[model samples]
Target: MLHCPRKTARTLVYSGIFLATGLAQAFALDPTGDWRVADGVANIRVAECNGSMWGAVAWEKQPGGRDTHNPDVSKQNRPTLGMPILIDMRKKPGVDQWEGQVYNAKDGQFYSSTIKPLSPDQMEIQGCVLGFLCGGETWTRVAGPIPSSPANSMAKGPPKSPGAPPHTAGMTAPKTTGSVGPKTPGQKLATAAHPADPVGDICLLPDIAGFAH
Candidate 1:
């Protein structure tokens, strides 16, 4: 059988493209886990939300800290311990990075954020203000099984540590008595619910239906 040179070249090119795409998809990183941030001062739980990923502060050193610097006067009094800071993070196609917005509780500013997994246990998080000036930190994964239910996960407050008197401005300190363990599948939901402000109209990606909490 006679073979054309052009046909052989086209077959090689197609094969290369297929392999590249396959590798990208195979190695795609999932950022759904617990991450320690702010030099271990806080722990945030990242989970699936509306086809994307959203993270909320699951634990903090100072559980009574309020959003004192928030731009909105009404929200300034809200507790920062359980606030959602990582919103609507979607994996960029054919890449190892996720793009989203990160809300800084200290300054109450939202910045363009990118998350890249350096390894299974570590991630590099970068937030930029003007697409030029940027700052970032390496976040380490928290070792534990995340709570099974949304209510169990979101409602549980951080364990208290021995420290100075609790800051008593806007919120009271979370009770330090309960065990912060993973809840069973059929665990009864708490009667008093923790408030999760809706992220409606704040998500950069409109296709996402917004987070429930």
Candidate 2:
């Protein structure tokens, strides 16, 4: 028969408790949900994409509800809609952080970015094009499912203008699981709409570079 000391048993119990506490904290800090980021300059909403950890901005509210600066948009006199913004984010080892690219749709520029979630409902995003000239923004959690296939519709509608702003709504991501399911056409389409890029394995908006500046 094997025997264990009382002190060893106590140590094992404490270790197990510590591990559980850490896991709970991690779950609480996971920033996996719909979020809204708006400054006086712009208002944008994004949701997690299906099959990938990346979230895409599906809605953009033009600042002031009018394009007073650009004549092209002024001529149309319409709000910016359907703008794709955020890229896919992959978790980094040993930290509660995600790193990915952030493309400026208006200028077709890509920046190195990092998202460190402060809480389940808050995250600090730091983006930099030239490394030193970095800008940071904080995003607040929004009430919507994370972007996914069910949320994004494939019903072909009226022809959208070539210059139509990127989308910022219409889908949410799903929780990661090990269960494998048969793929369908809708799933294939979703994968096409938000293709995985070379920079990361996470799914993100394929056309996020075209967002209005």
Candidate 3:
């Protein structure tokens, strides 16, 4: 009968995992790339910097060519381009979302932000002011590389397709005006836009809409 040492078995198991994880990480698709913020106010480009990954804001789409948010701060004399806005938060098991922080160039404020991977090409960024004081907005993915300059972005024309038909908002269809029909999905249940399941309240229906509720 042949007997393997306990320590040797443990070492072999851990070594296998370590090697597999190292290979996985090496081949993992990195999200570090060019991304444009909502409204094109900021264009962020991520690349390897200082032996670590960092992002730099290449161009800012200034409406009036002025930084009204932080006028005192040197818009030009900044140490880094985009600055250290977001940090790698976590990569939890069974979860695909990547958590991070978002630094507001306006008041120099940092907020808890998250980048949810919608698909291979699309991601949603949720950023707020503080403790729900300010509302959060979603950012859609833009095609191609982030514009180098505001002029270049403008020259490309509107963000939407040029030949696309004009959008008509707030146009509602004629109501039947007869009887109150059955409630649809939206009316049937409520869901939290941003939910933090601490205790794990697994409800059948989406009853709680707000985080607190």
| TM agreement with the true structure for every prediction | 0.57, 0.49, 0.40
Each model's lDDT = 0.58, 0.48, 0.39
lDDT of 3 by residue, 24-139 (tens): 75433333344566776754543222112223353346423333355456553453343445543343345555555566666766677666555434456666655576454544
Pick the winner on TM-score between candidates 2 and 3: 2
lDDT of 2: 0.48
Top candidate by lDDT: 1
Residues 1-213 of candidate 2: C-alpha lDDT, one tens digit per residue: 656799789999999999999887775564554456746343234433332244444334442232233334532343334333456656688987777777565555667888877875677888987688998989875432222333233312232222112233563322221111123454354346546312121232334322211
Residues 1-213, candidate 1, lDDT per residue (tens digit)? 999999999999999999998776554344655568848888666654434556767667666878899899988987776577787777798776779999998789999998887765677889999796899998877632232233223332342222122233453222211212233231223102323312212111122223433
Please list the residue runs of candidate 1 whose C-alpha ends up more than 4 Å from where it truly belongs after superposition. 1-28, 144-213
How many residue pairs in model 1 have overlapping backbones?
Answer: 0
Clashing pairs in 1: none
- TM-score order of candidates, top first: 1, 2, 3
Find the 10 residues in a row with the least total lDDT in model 3.
Answer: 203-212
Best by TM-score: 1
Q: What is the C-alpha RMSD of each candidate to the true structure, in Å?
A: 13.4, 12.6, 19.6
Q: Which 10 residues in a row give candidate 2 its minimum summed lDDT?
A: 173-182
Q: After superposition, how far is residue 198 of candidate 3 from its true place, in Å?
A: 43
